[model samples]
Target: MASSCTKLCLQCRSLLCSKTVASTWKYATRAHHCAAGTRIPVHFLNGFSVLNEDQKTTQTRLRWKQQMLYYSNLSAIHQTTEVKENKDSEELSKANVVVYQNPLLPVDAVPVTESQMSLDLDAAAELSALEEISDEEAVGISVPFALPPASTSLRDYVDQSETLSKLVQLGVNLWKLEQRPNVGSMLLRLNFNTDVAPRLLFLKEVGVENSRFGYIITHNPFILTESLENLQARVDYLKSKKFSSETVASMVSRAPYLLNFSVKRLDNRLGFYQQQLQLSATNTRDVVARLPRLLCGSLEPVKENLKVCEIELGFKQNEIQHIVLAVPKVLTANKRKLTQIFDFIHNTMKVPHHLIVKFPQVLNAKFLRIRERHLFLEYLGRAQYDPTLPSYISPERLVSLPDETFCVQLALATLDDFYLFQKTL
Candidate 1:
């Protein structure tokens, strides 16, 4: 049964954000089970828009028809890769991890070699050991004079630069210098690494009247590299591939360049990205689609009911031929929770056009310049979207958005950083 397409909940977000005017996401289309013991027929959040219900047999088929609200994450490692699936690929189910840190030891005292319960104590240790230091080489940003007013914080833009700014703004020295050349960019990276880097966002309206509508937003979008000097090399990596003109332009325009890779917490790595690859197929001619729970309350309900939940989704593909190029070598320091939180944060604000046009294509570019990479694995929010308002935003607010369209706003912020690309205008 095909569920009818409906408008997304933008009112709640606008009321909450009260500022900011833009957002984007990556979506892949593929097929997969919705929830255990639940065959909810809806689009998959990872990317696939059409679920291969044919695969939904009496045992493997979906039972209920639910709408999914997806926020795509283009930066995640696997989503960027095109992994070939062997029907015989091994699947690990129910992998559990237990931690045994000494109660007497402060959380920070747990050593990298010791935190086996957490996936990457080494990475955590690396993160904790990072000192609060600013790079003398600050990069510059040439905005079009009309960057949307900070009326809405970055959280208002995608996740939580809104309140996070409040924390960073407390740093009068850094906050006041943003208008200076290369200062804003340098400070943004600095703030991302500090205690202020761990974002805190509220899933409002989740009160007793709307518990199901609210969910948590995680921090993500981390930079793999620390210096802006790496931007040139990263851009060169993309330009070697010969991408489309539009791809090159967007990347160049957003340059300086920062990785700001997003992560999510997952007990199982294979399980998480598996869904990413499959659901992403919907945008193309994939065989099936799996939907997430984007909406609820029967067609008969007519009125906005609280039974529905909306989730932002993020999906990215590197192309079937280069599928092998996208898989990430295990980061000796990477953590499972970090990855999961990145996913949650990425999707929460991933824009729709991201994968349909930019992500893969940019990788195809022959001349790309990456100026910076911000590695953030922080917590953001747990909020709900009201399924009743407009789904699309007005183009006036965001030149990237469609005209007169009511937009779907993500109640989350990204753990990623704002990447700056370069080329002569």
Candidate 2:
């Protein structure tokens, strides 16, 4: 039996391999390959096995021509094996995706594939015995070794398929993430190839702290040429860089929210928006995603009389199925004018007794207060611009509107001791 199997291995090898492959052997049961990948068992069709029982059991195997049906079955089995190998390769690639660094993952190493599978030497000999069946004797030959067309270069093909699949997954996740307001455009932004591998290794070394972020990294790996951690470390080395979490949060709040930018700039927002833009219901109360219907209700419809247009105002998740309020391009531009108009309130225009937010919102006859003056601008800015309020005192008709991004840039740009936006506000 061993001798017969050995003869079959030698014979079938030529039919199975490239002419370049130096004598491909049926892998010995005891022989091992360090990176053999995986092998799977395939059950032949029951009917084929039953019908071929006599032929399979026969010691004097029919020449290839005499056993066309058996050869056809063998060809089918080979094709199935090829498909199985491709699938195994795909799965192996997925599992070995380098996990991001954190306590969850600690190190990086080579990818491995293993399976407790053994191929029958008798079956291999049976395949080998088919090699002697000449094409004329067999009626036809099915060449398993007839390689696929050489259109896809070996290196490029592997990389294009593997890396592209992983990258596509990453892009989809990022698209989903962009729907959230704060971090819509956040992604690794890989600039180079050399940078990618190390960054991937770093993630595998550190393990991503945020699993969502980590998942993105594992699939679409990127390495920053310069470590952000090192930059953060150097910041502390230079000065007392650390601040309280509360302080940071407060700072962010005070850091000039660019609510009203240009309509053109607003149009540019599609690029930034991710799919998952989760905002806390508590902190950002009465969250206004876009503008109200008082802006453009006439264009859409007359649902619940959108004239003056503010439906679903007092909502609690129920009783509200989205109100397609008019997007207020006019109010946005007008409210922008109000920033300067609010500032102009102290010197230029007179604040009416009823229009409290026009100037000194929180008591005292003067335009400013001692304790509340620094933060007073924020309160008045919102009060003067709050779309919900029934304000006959419109700052919309002002001469000039402050550019919100410029206002933000100007506000944050300088290291001035005093608030620069105070003048603009």
Candidate 3:
């Protein structure tokens, strides 16, 4: 039994030695190919020829452990290199991204260091520890102009001189200054005695009231920038065209931008109106003074309305002049609206253009209101508008009177009836 057991042990040891040699030989061949030109130890190649069988097995086990450790460390180093590469790529992509910033918002201050923050805290503490001084003990520091309190409006800040103060008293407020900052800044740089006062005095000399100075300036700030010589020239041109000083003042006050027109431009506008309306110089001055805005914008609207009156509405030249003289607004009224009103009056109401000239206010009333009232009157059989008739209802009163007044006075109907009629329409 002992001999058989010894034989079994020897056979198992021989089998283990054969497997270890085979694995070692395979590993060494692979390592030689992978390392290319690396030298192998003589004992490793010779398969531990000098060592005994037990020693050879022990050395084989140690070599296998060392190779396994080397492979694990190599895998760990490869994974670490890939992770570092990925981290660097992510940082580069983040650097390429763009961030947007709004121009209107205030920029953030630089980050405060710990030492700087500590110093700031110390400074604040020292400041708080300082004693407060009385107003009498405070030193008076004179500046070019006294800055107003922060609580006051921007106008207060702008009113640094007596001239600016006078403007504030008149009517220029913070809103007006902000709306035209360029003009406000220009005024600030101007000398009151040399630049602004002369213009104020000129406006006054032209007969503009002191109270109107604010209104004029607020409406047309460019008036301040106009040279006194140019302003005088404009005023002189108006006077030369037979405009009285009071008429010129009224025109300027009503349309503060009037003096901004050059002498040639003013003459051209006056001549155009005179020629178009067949007005004498006196009548032209009166018409222009009544409606100064006529010379303000483009004359294309005026020309179109004139064509509408003559060609479309079939008004003669003289009748057109009478209509304009009565209501100067007729010249600037929307062409289509003017035609609609004239069509309803001439064809629907059987009123003549001659009658419209006398009561031009009919053209200014809303078209729907005119239609409702006229239809109501026609329904009652009291729509007689002829002056020769006994129950003559003037075209002016038809539009000018309120609903209640028209119902009671002109229509001879109750307010309820008129309101009911309007709703039905």
Candidate 4:
């Protein structure tokens, strides 16, 4: 028995040596094509050796198979860990951040820093810090005008000057000046003196109502600094054009900057109305009174408007003149607006041209307002627009009434019904 066991042991040792050498040779053959510095695992080589050993017993083969499986599981776990680490590094490199500060600030207000970009930062904490900083810095700075540093209250800044105070008292809306930095600067730059009072009084002397004087000066603050001589000259020129003193005051109250225009500028606009539109003196005066802003702005726009009316809409030149005289605001209408109103009156409502010529105010009404009232009257089955019918309501009566008045006089609906109709619209 001993002799037999010794022989078996020798055989096993020789088999183990031969198998190890064969497996090592196989590993070297597979690794021949691998890049330099690539590592070959020792346990995988050992696994091959265990599988190829000359073990005759079933128990010995089972132990080798268990050892191989253990090494394969460990290898799989290591590969998974390595892949996870690589993905984590990739995510860290691609992170981005946005800072929500005021757009009005200069670039130098918030400098970019490396620490702000770190992955470990708490985003909520950083965003709150940025918003707080923005509020503290963004209060009084304007893009067009550099304001005095807001060390004092805006009201206090206005109170330091007598001119600003008088302007506020004279009816310049304090709220408007406070909101606009440039307007505040304009007020600060004014050369207010006893002359200021006289200029304001000049508006009153010209027939500008006391209640309206403040509103006019507030709207056109430049009027406060206008020369009394220049203002008088504009007033005298208007009188030369046949505007009564009361008419001049009403014009100034309606548009105070009308007095700010030079005499030549006024003449050019007046000439356009007289010669170009062929409006007579009374028509010219009426047009100016009705639409003073038309004279205040360029006549080129008015000319363009009239050209569109005559050429595009196919109206006779006399018809254009009549429209201008009756509703001078028609000259102020933009091309798109004029097209829409003309289309509605002629094509949609089917109103005749003679009636439109008689009451041109229908052309000046807003398209939506016209549609709303017409549809409401049509809804009540009371839109008796046939000229032959006695119950017919004229386009003038249809659109000219105030909402409450229209509800009572025409629709016979309550004010609440009109309001609800407006909401649906």
Candidate 5:
């Protein structure tokens, strides 16, 4: 058996050594490189193993062909993958543009090309010549008349004037005089051309303080141009209302526009407060002194607010007066806010009616502040919702204290907790 096996191996070796098989072996070996990157696996090489030498030789050939086919398929796959990646990259490079077709053109219209540029040159030249002639006829060739010389002299004159200097110092831009050339003449007439010193003395006589007159004039330069008779009448009206000279000066300083108000306008505003609102002379003066602009506003709205507070919201005449005296701003509150506040105080908080009159300033408190303080106190068991149960903390104490003092003394909650509670709400 061993001799037969040896003989069979010799015969197989001889057959494998023939020219055709030898050529195929040499071609396969040369074409298929075995390197670290492309080494054949041991399992793959063993897959062709056989006990018979002839079978082994045939299997080795089949394995080589299988490996070659696998490598060919792998190369084909890699090339296809590269081609797909390049195509994808090209697609990515293209921008996503929204193209709208021209409504006048056909949807499938072919793009114009350079060959379509051929045109009749002589006809184009004649058309251009005709257009030029039409344009020439339509447009007259008159030269622009010389512009009026820039007002160098007026600017130079203003730059030299002491009065103009004073105005410029008070934030008045003289460059604006370009728009109102008459203002230049007005300034010149008031400061230099007219008797300004006597008029200034007259203003002093009218209770305009010497120190404050400059500010008044600076604010309303027209005051200098106003007739002395008209000025005196306005001043006389204020004096007739029992406003002292000091008060008049202070009012003028606070609102220079008051001087510009006519006697009839002034009387109307004063009468509204004194007659319609029935504010006493003292209260009227206090309201005006506190907020001079109050008189400048329309009386009808203020009257309506006062009426709502007194007649509809059940605030007494004297209580309204107290609110005005304490916080004159409260009288200016809108009707809805006035009603809401009254309701919140009288119905919601269960505060006594007379108590509000006693502390009208509580009405002046912001509704949010009043609500926060009251609710916090109720939470702390320091305030009773029932009006009959005397409050542990007075409404005055609740609203009046600053945040830190209120937290430490009244709410007894940490500042963080109080602020956090506010944010949550």
Candidate 6:
């Protein structure tokens, strides 16, 4: 009986040990699965029924500790992952950054030192100071007020009574000033005593009459802006071109814009007329002195007229030169009118080109007048232009004589008869 009891007791002890070990094994497996973020099997929890009350309490406490440890480990892992992601994002941002470099600087250029930089600044300051001093010296005195901006209107300065008074004293009336607001605006900026008076004095010295100052300035206010030296140089150039002092003065008075032309321009114009017309220097000077405005306009008309006189009118080069010497304005005459006059004289009047050259003034007469007179003379059987023939009329007398004089003297008829004859045409 005793031997049988011992074997049974050992079997019972072995069964209890196996149950405890199985329960512990299941509990450990569940904790491991929970920690690994996997699902805990429901069968693993059933093993806890085999345990005693004390063992169950201890097993419950162990499970609770394991769950807490598992959650703590999960939080640590999640924080580590977030830190890694942030580090990667920072690296990507660093890769995307761009750096800029100036292309103008030389690759080997040295950075400027402080001393050199300070010296450059000082030199710039000195240059600006010197410029200011030079400006004061150029004006010959300190300016009382700031000069008006370039865009300021002349009307704005019109309210300034002193400026208007000075302009009035110079004979530039309000009407004249209004005629050229641009000139008046520029004049408003000038110092009257230093800038304006000197130009007036210079004009006087150049033989521009004092009485004509108002006319000259009104016609060409820009003359006041020209430098004295330049005005003198232009006068000298005219004198050098064989124009007398009085002739130069008279030319300036007649054509205020003539001096506005550069010396080279005047020379070219004189040379062109002289070379084209084949005139002597003295004759060229005489022509320009008589017609100063000839120097002002384009030479193209003059050129076209020369070609017409030579090619169309059949005037020899020498004959053209003679005509131009007699009538300097003929060079600038309308090309079509000139052609018509030549056509009438040559084709209708049977007048020779040489005779036309002898009286180039005939070219200056109105075409209708020339035609009427020639037709009248032709009616009278007195239009014989041959110098060798009897009762031959010079071309000059044909056109130059007044209507009454032409009828009685050249046409050899009464004025009433001439008028009657004109009505028939």
Per-candidate TM equals: 0.15, 0.19, 0.61, 0.59, 0.49, 0.57
Query: Candidate 1 on 261-346: residue-level lDDT in tens?
Result: 11121112223334433433223111111111011112222111111101121233333212212311111112343234334323
| Cα TM-score of candidate 5 | 0.49
lDDT of 2 by residue, 1-425 (tens): 99999999988876756311221121111111211211222122421211223333232232212223433433454444545554666664443232111122112211222320112233344546546676685777555443234432222232334433344443334443334443322232343344444544443333232233334433222223346465233223212323333332232122212112223432233222211112233211211233322211232332232222223222221111122112223222332332343344532343432342232222221233221232333334422333355432233222122334322332223323225645544
Candidate 3 structure, TM-score to reference: 0.61
- For every candidate, C-alpha RMSD to the true structure in Å: 42.9, 26.5, 19.3, 19.5, 27.6, 24.9
lDDT by residue (155-190, candidate 4, tens digit) is 655656777677667666867655655666666766
The lDDT of model 6 is 0.72
Error of 4 at 301 (Å): 2.5
Worst 10 residues of 6 by lDDT: 96-105
Candidate 4 achieves a global lDDT of 0.69
Tens-digit lDDT string for candidate 5 (183-292): 66677545633545555777677667666765666555666677778878888888898998878777777676777778999887877777655788888887887767
Which regions of candidate 6 are displaced past 4 Å? 1-195, 420-425
Off by over 4 Å in 4: 1-154, 178-182, 402-425
Where in model 3 is the C-alpha error above 4 Å? 1-125, 128-165, 173-177, 191-193, 388-390, 402-404, 415-425
List, residue by residue over 211-283, the lDDT tens digit for candidate 6. Answer: 8887787788788788888888888999988788899999998888888888999999999888877788889
Q: Write the per-residue lDDT of candidate 3 for residues 11-87, one digit (tens) a residue.
A: 97686554334534554454444333222222344332121234245545454444444433433433444445545
Can you tell me which runs of candidate 5 are displaced by over 4 Å? 1-168, 171-225, 384-391
Worst 10 residues of 2 by lDDT: 23-32
Top-lDDT structure, candidate number: 3
